[model samples]
Target: MQRILEALGWRQGSFVKPETVAKLIGDIDSTFTISANNLLVVASQSCDVASSQEEYIELSIVRPLSAEAFNKQYSHNRHPRILHIEANSNSSDEKVILELKAHEKIQIKKSLLEEFKPDSSINFLEGNLNQYIDWLAGRYKRPALPTKFDQLIASSDKKGKRKKIAKRANEYLTGIYVDIYPNRDIKDEETYSVNLLGIASNDQSIASATDALNEYADILKDAGMDVSVPKVGTEFKISVGTLRQYQRINFDYLSYEENNPIPPDTGI
Candidate 1:
């Protein structure tokens, strides 16, 4: 005989349908009402969910990707507001896009979850679990950039080249590192220097990656930023009055794959 909780799918990435919510937790309270039409995925650390440490398990709500977001390659991915999980990864039939919003997370009683049928619940890919957890945690962990600096990076959208560049770059690049000049909190009045260090996802992508990166440099130059992108594994100095910033700017639109674990930079 299986242990009560052992038979339950309480691990991170395990998700159940809205109809299952009423069966598991019941309609005695409004949780089911709050969770209508949403796919529920365990959001807490898997170890924490397995332990008898808490009364409730954190779960995030999954919803259909909007038409606009679905069409945009990068908007639905690696974004702070939501995460895009492909349908195939979730056992859905269509090759559609699904969005999981961070703010919409809910906590359900662990006791109720333990009673649900294990086989009925669907799960996201084991490989995607880490990224999902990081994305969830990143909701709070997002870097706080100087308002102007952030706006400056976001300004690339005005050039209308970012989408083309991002689509190309995310397709061919694997990992990224960045260095910022005058390494302190940047002010709005001054121009800053940026260096991008990038890796090609594979041998086949090196040529494509080179092309995309060159265009990326042009995008930065057009923005009045002095930028450099070094070859993979090349070393650079982080001198005085300089700091390395991640999750701030450069290739933020790039999504991840199992082949590459290191995340790329934010939008440039």
Candidate 2:
């Protein structure tokens, strides 16, 4: 989990800075409620460096749910839920809340098995399931953009500058999956697979996307993170295709619903 947060650009701290916490939720006499199960880490906030846009960083921490509680709430449903808590009375001022259980990883794996059915005659190699899980969790949480990147994008409404910043942002990797399979007899017998995915522009080629991802990994390494660039391959194509199809179906359904009128109900 520390590795995951570090990869997402969070710096671990014994406590979230007093000033930072105050800035986020306004002044309070009591300190943030930290527990043994959860600790806070600061995320570098970025905004238009030159503009009057308020520049403030965000702090995030994860609290793990117990297996018993998790199973009782989500075992049958198998879907992670999110709730946003509004700090002030204003609806716009809301804080993100993410919760995950011990069983979620296994449940996610089971869902993947049902989706792919890898063992049925097709010799499909499983990618890093952990990476997929991380991606699933992280995709909902927005990462803070680099200040410079944000500045570049906001400096002008020019298409070229926007495209350039978009390209750069696309290369920032969000999730890393490490696959582990156990051996029956030997404790040391295991195979490791790592998979990473990044946000990229629609027009970017696979090669360009891969290069951008590697560059981001290099940046993480420079920051003293124990990170490595993995060879980009076709492991995620199946999921991509599935998502695209699902999106298309949803689009069509929404379009139909929008265009068609509701039939008047007859008393049955």
Candidate 3:
């Protein structure tokens, strides 16, 4: 279990996709209290059963910490943080069958007995539990953007007030002072925190500013918010301070003044 946890780091992968999130939800939804036998089965199924150990842990102890509430608090996107084996030893059959189904229909027909010579003493592991959780967090963590343009509009009219405009201006200028991070998807929430570093204009109208803002919007869309022009003639300036450690700022393009030095990427 320690090895498994060590292997599953902070990055996303195939097994750690959205279905793992659904499975975590489903597991919590199905049982209010997990039986001791179920916990033992989960533990047994997760690890290779070389031999039985007498000091097997209790389900009550593991279930609560391994439950959805724990996941909601610790694991991003409510992903399962713990993996355990579940063993069922009561089957009377000499052959074990593994089914890979797609929507209740068999996708690729393969029976364990036919595929590999059946050994009644050995148990076949069903799924890669670690990868499933990674995939889940990767999927649900970044939600999709809305289909229509109206959806991007701020619901409150006061959102465009002078105070808010000043705040947004600060946010954009602040972008030049911080280190920015990469975004995995357009709907990512962390992207909103980063500011627009600079802007360029093709024309003088509000529409032109909107177009430039739209370009920056494309850069930040995957991060979180949509782009819109501030009313025409909106210009602001600021003197950059020393960047905070680990804070990031991003720009679509950047130009340095003559004799000015460029910042280094921290690779966080």
Order of models, best lDDT first? 1, 2, 3
Error of 1 at 77 (Å): 4.4
Decoy 2 TM-score against native: 0.23
Question: Per-residue alpha-carbon lDDT of model 3 for 123-207, expressed as tens digits?
Answer: 4234433423332233223222222211222332223332233234442322222222332222523333333333212233335
Give all TM-scores, in the order shown: 0.66, 0.23, 0.18
CA RMSD of each candidate after superposition: 8.2, 24.9, 19.4
Tell me, by TM-score, which candidate is best: 1
Top-lDDT structure, candidate number = 1
Writing each residue's lDDT as its tens digit, candidate 2 over 94-155 gives 33233433222210111111111111111101232232233244334322222222232234
lDDT of each: 0.57, 0.29, 0.27
Q: Which parts of model 1 have CA positions greater than 4 angstroms off?
A: 1-9, 17-19, 24-37, 64-77, 86-98, 145-148, 151-160, 168-170, 173-177, 186-191, 199-201, 222-224, 230-268
- Candidate with the larger lDDT of 1 and 3: 1
Q: Candidate 3's C-alpha lDDT?
A: 0.27
* Candidate 2 lDDT score relative to the true structure: 0.29
Candidate 1's residue-wise lDDT over 197-266, tens digit each? 5556677777776676677667767767788764442123232233244333433433332135444334
